[model samples]
Target: MSKTNLDIQLKTIPESAGVYQYYDKEGNIIYVGKAKNLKKRVSSYFTKTHDSGKTRVLVKRIADIKFIVVETETDALLLENNLIKKHKPRYNVLLKDDKSYPWICIKKERFPRVFPTRRLIKDGSEYFGPYTSMKTVHTLLDLIKGLYQLRTCNYDLAEDKIEDGKYKVCLEYHLGNCQGPCEGYQTEEDYQENIKAIREIIKGNFKDSLGQFKQQMKDYAEKMQFEDAQRIKEKIEVLENYQAKSTIINPRISNVDVFSIVSDESFGYINFLQISYGSIIRSHTLEIKKKLDETDKELLELAIVEIRERFNSKSKEIYVPFKVNIGEEIKVTVPQLGDKKHILDLSLRNAKYYRMERFKQIKITDPDRHANRIMAQMKADLRLSEEPRHIECFDNSNIQGTNPVAACVVFKNGKPSKKDYRHFNIKTVEGPDDFASMEEVVFRRYKRLLEEEQPLPQLIIIDGGKGQLSSALKSLDLLGLRGKIAIIGIAKRLEELFYPNDPIPLYLDKKSETLKIIQQLRNEAHRFGIEHHRNRRSKNALNSALDTIPGIGEKTIVELLKKFKSTKRIANAKLDELEEVVGVSRASKIYNHYHKE
Candidate 1:
């Protein structure tokens, strides 16, 4: 369409709640969105500037526009969700779940059979769940089978068919697995009652079932049927055990959906938990690939709609970590305390774990993508202008004011580059002055790197507080590289991050990946610096005893030590043994010095 035609269409759009679709020249739906007012929302897409480049590209590609007017915002939201799933627009977040989950079905027959199946048929039979895994379905089926004497065979147990004697008892009936409904052994009313209990159990409410089992057990015991009573008692125990495992919160919180999100730069993970009678009936985590740098609220809202539709949930209430504008039909709650908050936290944890598992998997299968994500995350978390692909961290070690030294550890793509690790002896600073020592080493390290034309790190980490950070900054300023590189200092007491010219320190979450990498760098530098310092202290101690001799130099001391291995051995060596390793005059002097000592 021409610009004129687009302008005309934009003007003609109705100002009401509706879903809008944008299409390219070839008539492919490229995006779908819902709004409370169609005219304003659709016009804003073209009138305002978009921060995301992809959104700009999407707007530029739009050659035609279409919309579906709805009476309410809820209808618009539903329509938008359906259209997005159906067309799967190129510019929208991709919801990619392709597995066929299993569901427990109660067969629509005279004697209904309960079984697990992957396929759902609309033949008037009731389906309980589209469970996350087949193992869960099998476990529930086993629990149901243990509790009820239901038939496994496909037999019509109609009143007329049983009266005409059309069917006989099968092996299931002989083995006591069924009540022999095919041969009129079980009445329809009694069978219906069992089915009702099973329905409640499948809904994650075992209260009625447990009560019925206990009553049955008591009746059997009163009649002196001890074997039947024992069996009933066992069933009651099984039900109670299952309920205990499933019930995680107060039993009053039932038939609700909980959603929480954890997102990175490229993707969002949304975890959905369906709770019934304080028991978790279903759990699923959806991974959505972000197209336009969508916010958590937007991704979560879309995911809640999609997951609810996919799972066939009719839940009227939902618990979320924050408020969202996902229509008015379903109650959206931001739980702040008690069991509700606990469950919300659990959902968030699930999302985080799912994201972590994906990262681990991606790191092994696609290391480049993993590195890119970490780099991007670090860049954002540290408020850097670009990704810190190559980072260097510095630490000083001067325990007890001895063997003052510093270490520089380099990290490339978030992993330590051990070969690039450098140790610096505190030549300019006296005693344990960490600030001056840090300044001298920082100046020397970068001065040499600049002189040799080596690539500089994008970020520098100083292992101390603001004083150390200021010292490092002075070195960078002297080299005219102060603003060229990003630098921060980490305080050990609180893990506080100090930035240059910033008074308030930034405290990242303890479990955040960015903080973990920062902590790793700090620790590596500390270990490297300490190791070098220890070696220096040991070497100085060894040389102190040997330096006292008037005529002996470093070369003579080295040669005598090479032969005698230590000062104690050199002192004990005979004149001829010392003379063989060193010259005669030096050997005599060294022997006299050690023997006199």
Candidate 2:
């Protein structure tokens, strides 16, 4: 398709809700999107400037455009989700789940067997869940088994077979685990009643089951059947215990799905919590790799549709942190307070934990990818024009205006480059003036880097407030490198970041990865500066004490120190030991000086 033809198609596109597909030159669909207004959404792609390189590339790849108009925005969303899943277009967010989840299945048989399965067969059987884990399925199954006497056999217990006496009771029946449904001991009506209660239990509704059990126990107690009453009491306790563990909020907040997201530059983690009668019946997190720098709202909307379909959820209501468009069929509630907000927070926490776990795994398995993500995150968080792959932080250390020194710590790809760390001895600055000290080092560091043709850091950090930042800026201006590198100052009081010429300081989230890396750099610079200052002070103290001795030149002091390791050791050394290291004349001068003191 030519550009002229593409413009004509865009003009013809209707201003209505629909799904659109962009095809590449090879006639393959590259992207699929949902829009409330097809014309406006599709036209914006071509008209607006995209920040993400991938989005720009996707736009340039378009050789043709095709769309299907839908009756409503919700329909458009569903269509987009299906088309993306079917075609898996090149520029769509990738949904990466491949593991088969477990489901509790009620078989379609004479005496239906309830068991956990990973495969779903369309045989008119009822499958309750595609649970997140096998452990949850087993736990529910165990609770059901403890509460009810159900058949767990594969025998054909037809009326004719029972009449002919072909099937017999198994060991499960003798062990009191089953009610002998294979024989005539349990009728179909009685078995169906138990099945109905089990269905409610599986749906997380325990009111009816608890009421029935309490009634049975009361009747047994009235008849003086103490053992039977006690057994019934035990079953009630089991059901209550299971419900207690599963319930998280008010029981009235039922049949709702809660979703929350924690996202980064490359991926979005959306956690879904299915609430049935205020109990969390299902919990899962979906990881979606971004293709075009999708927003959290967009990712959440798409993931809500995908996860609900995958989990076979028919929940009519959902709790979210913000409003979303996913059709009016399901009520979307932005929870603000009370139990609803708590559940939403829980979903967010789960998403954060999942993201953290993925980061840990990727750090070991794909380190380059981890570094790229951190750099990207820092770039966005700091509002930089490019990723800060190389960063340098400066800190000044001086005790009582003595031995003032500045340290510059280098970080490559968000980790310390210890070999590149440098220390400045505050040569020009006569006193403990941090601002002047910072200016001198900043100028000297970059001047030498330029002279040696070494690469300059993308970012520079000054460990002070606006005054220090302004001082560093003056140095950059003198070096003709102002605005070429991103620089900020950090104040110790509140961890506030001061940008040059900006009075309003930026405060990053304390827990964010960007802030953590920045804090690490600042601390490293401080420690490195303190260490150098301490060494300079110690060297000056040693020189002053040894230089006063007559005929003990720098060479003799060096040789004696090398042999004795310290001035104290030299003073304690015997005459022969000192003579062996230095000549007898210098040894006598050093020993006599220390003894006189």
Candidate 3:
């Protein structure tokens, strides 16, 4: 544990490519790393100056060392990644709770039962997915069921068992969902043909099944069996539809592993997209917690090795955004353009989106920290003097200058406070004047809050550009609150955020959490305003519709609506039905009004 002991221990390390682990006094692995020469790499920690502050701290805590020598650098890289994942060392890029996703398995048995499972037993079973979504697995299984009559029972229909009549055809066979392989009614060779087609379909190659269906259709048509031909044509259409939905990239870019990474200060997200016959067969993103200030290249290399080994990838080449030292067995390409670059970009987008989703999940799980981070980000991004903990957004909605309304949505601690949301019917603004409507709503909302001596929002978002923002600012000025609260307007056209007296709008990254929160505010206010306006329009329509009936009064209309439940039901009611409800005289007038020839 002493410096002299550490120096003495380093002398025993091998001078070969291998994985090394550094341990603390507690005998727990503090770091896992791969090096070409273990002796030199392990000794360099004590011998050289480290620019990284984390490295210095890690070296100070190292009390012991362990190494695993491998034949090649690639093996070392792989072993290092695996050890890091399994042991979850304190100083390595590790994905937390990283469980293998589900795969659709076709058990290599008699009748070959197809189902979705997480386990991958190497018993000659054909596994398809390792899919990112269980829904995808269920979808493929459902599609297979719709296409072919495969057995679902777990009966062991060996040749001897079938010959001895050990099993009977069940309800599945009677329902035509299974081909009764248990009774030997379906020959093994014939059943194997269906299994072959299914294997191709699950592998993202639908051409074989489609071709066979087309051939079957042609044969039926030639024999003048038009119904059978039509059925086969329908089968071909289903295959084509599924194929069109799943296919995304060029078919020529096949059997390649594509990986992209996006990292922030504390964490890195690595997205892996597996392409087979031009379709993305597997798409997954991994979240890595950085123990040190690791570079993107380091994180990416570690992830690629871990992912490929976990997925059992046999890809001879990998498409990456930059070069990685993964060794000579698999080629790593940094594609500049074309489909290769496009695929890489797609993978990057997945990583970005995954990072965003993880951030959201974290916000839900750790509200206090997430709120602190978001408020800090907002303060920095918006150039506000303080964190806008309680924020409000306003939107105006009016269709064809009728029933103009406004909505005020509140966000408390980076989340919507639905109970505090307010809706305004534009009484002061006669027409569809959004600027005037915005001014009226803003004046009404804040004036009441100030009168009641209630807390006010730190930031206010206007759902339009300069005009609406200027209108809201006037209201704040009238309330002696101008410059007291931060206000901005977001233009619908380009998501440009406009500030008071600032001509050049500030453009935040479209994927930023701050932008997403602002967008959420805008959308919520718009939806609330639209809903309020629709309710007004519906009430007005009902009032005007009943007013047109000469003999029917407001009370009668209400009673009729209450009984009939809707205007359409009232319109469709018989003369006698209306009479039974509202008396003969009023019912005849209402019936005549509706049934005018």
Candidate 4:
């Protein structure tokens, strides 16, 4: 890690985009980083002489340098994350063991309940999170289940199984905690309504929802069902406690997302703060290990894009830690004090939690294993000529197929290259047709591939059954790009596998290792596509609201948002606070119309 040697390496390095490796003499990878300009970033380690000799020692041990040029920094990030995960380099301050953090698990039964658990099994149940805090997860589970009276039973109790006199209600039921659907004490509709209440509760409407819960408690009390009333009353109390916490954060929110990023040499963390209604409802952090030797500001920039990729724009107004290239009036700032500081602190705490809970774990299996094996399986099962070195997976996501977009994630050597990940907004298809959407994404992806002079992948994976695979293949054939990338289909549930010309293999008992890899690709694709759609959707919604405000020019809207966290908060703020915000009108036109006070 000597400065002189690093300078020498930088001197010989070409100013081109590529993946780079820092290796010790034993040829062990000390760190893996990607860069748009390898010579510039890599050589910085050597050229910048430091006070301490810590890096110098490691730099001296550098026996070799490895690199692969790529088209974009995004591709560089992808490759770096993949390499870091696969190799588990020594010099990287690795978030070693963490993966997806704990989420509150609600079992879907006749009673329909919510419980907190770390495991994500592909059962019939719905998962509401990839939450960062175990404490928050448990608190949320308790809040949702206790307040809603959603059952947490493990038994298959039928409607006729329990009679009020035949059996005493369980502790939860007697405490007015369970909805008591097991004894026909409540209908499915009532239980379902409870689920909606939980959703609204999580959305920061605890006070409003609390009022509604209290009415339910009153109804049960008036019916002379003191027991049920007591249960509902407890739920109201949980809601009240949460509401009290909300008071710590002032109101002025519609829907919005906030993000920040911090990085070191080998790993980085991005904090996501999600707000709705008027409260600081929830936040999350993504422990991103891949980057191109990101500077502090670069981390902040990626924070916006990363969170924006994950959230829909219609439901959110994003606040960033630094100015980003998000075009238009997206609010960006570096907080010094006030309510914004409170939110920023929350985001940072979440990032630390994720660093501990999710990012710290080392993945034993190289993600590239799936690609290597799937490629081998292709040779064995589909008679392919060779193992697929470059594996690509595509998936489309949108509600009612609106805002349809497809994500393409590239895998090389049993690992994902985030830098190589690409997204396609479904342009040609309308409505909820998966097949057509598949056709659109595939056609667009390969068309660009044909135009570009980069190496093409050997395999293509579509997130569907035969129909989707056929559509993609059709598009490829039309582009005269057949056989260039092997195409296959992966269907969920019985976890089926299908090749373009072969019959679908339903739930073939793929080994946990094999199943795990494909699932990762599909999940990443889903995550990437949905995030883009949501951020766009939320941004669009915010823009529409901005249009509705009077006497607020575009620059004024940006200034208002930059001044206040969200437009709704601006509307709710005192005139003095609004005026203090940068570029607010002295005439107070904005405060006059928007401020509720």
- For candidate 4, report its TM-score: 0.44
RMSD of each: 2.4, 2.6, 11.6, 28.9
* Candidate lDDT (C-alpha), each: 0.92, 0.92, 0.89, 0.68
What are the runs in model 3 whose C-alpha is more than 4 Å off? 4-16, 37-53, 96-100, 164-166, 371-597
Instruction: Output the TM-score of candidate 1.
Output: 0.94
User: How well is each residue in 1-597 modelled by candidate 3, as lDDT tens digits?
Assistant: 888888888988989999999999999999999998999988998899987789899999999888899999998887887787789887776654445789888899977888989888989998876787998888888888888889988887889999999999999989889878888899989898999999988878887898898999999999999998998888788878887877888887888999999976567899999998888888988887777778899899988887886777889999998999898989889999998999999999999989888878987898797788688788888999999999999999889999888899999988999999999988887777989999999999999999999999999999999999999999999999999999999999999999999999999999787899999999999999899989999988977887899978999989998999888899999999999999999999989988999
Better of 2 and 4 by TM-score: 2
lDDT over C-alpha atoms for residue 427 of model 1: 96
lDDT (10s digit) by residue, model 4, range 1-597: 455565566678878877899877687888776677898877777668854455666666677777888877666765665676689786553434454566655576766667766778888887655565787777766666555556666766665666534444588887766756666778877777777777767656665677786887889888999987987787677677777776445566546677766553445788877766656655656665443344555555544554444332344256666655443445555667777667767777677666545422433354343344445544544445666667789998877656777789987765789999998877777788888888888888888877896788877778888888899988999998887677778887666888767674635435434456677888998899889888777777776776776766787777777767686887677877766764456327766666456
Estimate the TM-score of every prediction. 0.94, 0.92, 0.64, 0.44
**Residue 489 error for model 2, in Å?**
1.0
State residue 473's C-alpha deviation in candidate 2, in Å: 2.0
Clash-forming residue pairs, model 3? none
* lDDT, candidate 2, 123-207, per-residue tens: 9999998999999999999999998888887787788898788888989989999998777899989888888899999999999
Q: Taking the candidates one at a time, how many backbone clashes does each contain? A: 0, 0, 0, 45
